[model samples]
Target: MCSCQQHSGTANSTSAPKDAISFRVEDMTCGHCAGTIKKAIEGQLPGSAVTADPASKLVSVVGAADFSAIKSIVTGAGYTPSPDRVS
Candidate 1:
């Protein structure tokens, strides 16, 4: 599942922007997986903000990102990313 959740308030130095595109990564089951996913996205998309939460299995990106690209990145990092549904 995935979602585009609207957010507000100050952008933390490391926080994804308000218009975050989120993906549900079922295979991201721990901090290490989250870090790998985050690293992969950030590495490919410089100047983008990424927040990967292992507990929630949510990977949010704030920058020039779309579902296909995000899914590709996650898949390249050996995980599965599903789009546009919450749960």
Candidate 2:
């Protein structure tokens, strides 16, 4: 798995609500894209359960984390989340 250390903030680092969420990602087109997005999320949330499916362009995250933080890491991984942001 690829290691992304540029952004390694704990999900608890924020006071915002932490819960599981499923949202569409606009640019997850391949396995590599899914893996990259997964890694990016894990990099920050550590124990967070992140499931990214290239076929569906949806990423499901279960654990602690703020929406902005999650979005930032996803974008940094070279993917754009859907316009809806969260689903």
Q: Find the candidate with the highest TM-score and give its number.
A: 1
Winner by lDDT:
1
lDDT of 1 by residue, 1-87 (tens): 222133222222333456888767776666677777888999998887788876667778878546688788888888888756332
**Model 2 over residues 1-87: C-alpha lDDT tens digits?**
233434332222111124667678766766666777888899888878787766566787888457778888887877887655453
The lowest-lDDT stretch of 10 consecutive residues in candidate 1 is 1-10
Pairs that collide, model 1: 2-85
Q: Return the lDDT, model 1, position 72.
A: 87
Residue 64 alpha-carbon offset, candidate 2, angstroms:
2.4
lDDT of 2 at 7: 38
lDDT (Cα atoms) of all candidates against the true structure:
0.69, 0.67
TM-score of each: 0.74, 0.71
Task: Work out candidate 1's RMSD over C-alphas.
Answer: 8.6
